[model samples]
Target: MKTLHFALPFVLIAVGCDMSPDYKQPELPVPSEWNTADDAERDSSHISAIGWKEFFTSPELQAVIDAALDNNRDLRIAVLNVEAARALYRIEKADQLLQIDAAANSSHQHLTEAEGAGPDGRTANHYQANLASTAFELDLFGRVHNESEAALETFFATEAARDAAQVTLIAETVNAYLQWLVDRETLDLLQRSLASREKSLELVTARQEIGLSSKLDLASAQAAVESVKVSRAIYSRFVEEDRNALALLIGKHDESLLPAEASLENTTILEDLPIALPSNVLLKRPDVREAEHQLKSANANIGAARAAFFPRITLTGSVGFASNDLGDLFTTEAAGAWSFIPQISIPIFDNGRNAANLDYSEVRKNIAVARYEKAIQNGFREVNNSLAARRLIREQLDAQRRLASAREEAYTLAHARYEAGLDSLLESLIAQDDMLAAQQAEIDALRQELSNTVTLYKVLGGGVLR
Candidate 1:
């Protein structure tokens, strides 16, 4: 027993040797600055520093986003995944520690006279109680330690994934809400246009009845009214569909949760993101962080694989007392038995299985590296795209608003001329059609601008803080 105790310290000292490789983060695969960032002003504050509640100023939108964070099914699944990964990590970490189990057992045997027993049959009973540790690895080559590290990294990756899911959910919910508002506004515009076109049709019919207008004029007026009706129908359906989509995201069907009336023009969102920020901000993004964590896990897996090439040492031990009489089980006079088993399994022959595992782990690490780089590149592209949209969409929206205004003026003039018998009703109808098209275009541009704002917030990792 004393010899075994003395040798255990030397065996434990061997655990200090680690075969895992050191890990270093890969270099960034993208440019240092954004292409569209030339005209952007520099700001010290990063977009990620701002929480979602601060970024989305609308109270209604804030409420809706909060509900989504709480009730979204995908987010729930993401949270659960994090928990499961944490549990797996715990299981791996436990492998590195000592685990002692208490066990008790009793045995009975009978020997007949015809067998190896004496003339008379004999019965025997045995009882035992012990504390034992079974097949505990010594981690001499860091296989178990590296495996624990890999599991820990995987847990962190899942946490980052949960954050990514949350960021995406917030962005989608906000965009859906904005789309619904835009659809409602468009529907209202179509309804008003239809009313005006219907009144014009009534006037054109009365004029034709009195022989003051031709059939062509009446037919043109009727066609204009029908066109507006068709647009109204389409937009009305769009509004309802948008509502359903928003409801699905919110995870509730209550009509009261949605606003009865809202306007895209009235909606407010934070638009000034720090466009001149450094590319390192991409690292703060949840998706990018998730990819990095996955890469770290793969790197750690390589360490475990490398460790597998070395010998593994396992120890099994037990200390117990055995006695024929049940009452003598704990007595000092009873026989005290103990066992120590130290097993060493050297990698002498495996048909290249360990080599294959090392190669596979290296390949997985390479794949993870590529994925991490791709994530950074994707984030860079999304930010640049949003920045370009932010600059160009504002200019385009300005032009659209101006065009709609001009069209409105042109329609008014054409209608006035027709009423004064200075122009044909065909000119008036054409101007009205152009005016409606321009108005719709302007509304669409506004919606795009708002949606882009929300998208910029998401791509920049704004909602993760919240």
Candidate 2:
């Protein structure tokens, strides 16, 4: 009988089988080299260590970034999600080992015989007590291992997702702050230009009264001054709105309290940017790592789904004692128990549930692979676009500066010629317009260049999340 029992275990092992299909990842569509980085040297110092302080270089902006990271609602949510994933992974890992549970119970019962005879039917009282009960499943195969690994991958994915959120948050804050700076600078410029135009109009009108200028020229100069004032008014409102936007990005909306400062010209700089490659290794952006983790998690799920077609072997057991007398329940002489029930479940038919699951897993794995490839391609595209944008903006800035300088010189010459009766008032007006336009264009180019750098930081996956 003992030999038969030992052979039964081997027989059950043979009975368990699976028929689920295997999973394969889809082909990658991404290129080996990124379009932007023609030569991204893999050096140790190539990575960006430019933190919020170094990148922003403004005390106020750094403070705002710190506050946003501390108070942002989205960041709080991401942190909670990471905790949840960690808990789930821990649970899955713990489940791999045996789980034991204990229970205590006491019962009393009275029974009466339904028959009567020379010996009359009598009532009997019984008492029973049990201290604990334990049950566990023995994992002989790798089912638990696959499940644990899947859970761990999900944990990593969530963690990476949180980091991705942080990167986006920082980028948004920088963009908002820069926008506020530009608006402030533009407002100041408009105000100053309006004042200058008003003074020019007064001078031209006085010349007309003295019979040195025509009435038509005086009217044109006054009209131009009025238009500048109108523009200044419009820009004033926009400046307030931009300040409000900056407040919102920092998780606050009280514009008066935020105290936005710093002009764009003072804060923005266009120069030869350092190209760091080695530091990028450590800054493995959350999105790229997140995509990879998602793929791994999907791969693990495929293993679990394929396991569905296979039979499962489980060993169930229980040991306990029950007695008519509560006092004797703990005694070994009164022990009563049955245990060690090992069973094997073979999947004879499931109406295609297992097959469908296998197919779903395969499709999901394919999707994950595609998503991973797309992320890489998108990352490369972003890098290329940012670098190109920066290059173009720098060139534009150079051209605008030269144009502004020429226009300024022309405006000075035209003003002197008009005073000497050698040039018309229209010529001075046109020169001033050209100068203002060129100055505005230079501002635009510089702001765009800085914005491009921000995009570069994001595309290169800066800001490590550790």
Spell out the clash pairs found in candidate 1: none
**lDDT measured at residue 152 in model 2 versus the true structure, 0 to 100:** 91
The top-ranked prediction according to TM-score is 1
* lDDT of all predictions: 0.88, 0.70
* Top candidate when judged by lDDT against the true structure: 1
Expressed as tens digits, the lDDT of each residue in 209-269 for candidate 2 is 8898898899889888887788778878887887777666667765443464555655643
lDDT of 2 at 132: 32
Question: What TM-score against the true fold does each predicted structure earn?
Answer: 0.93, 0.83
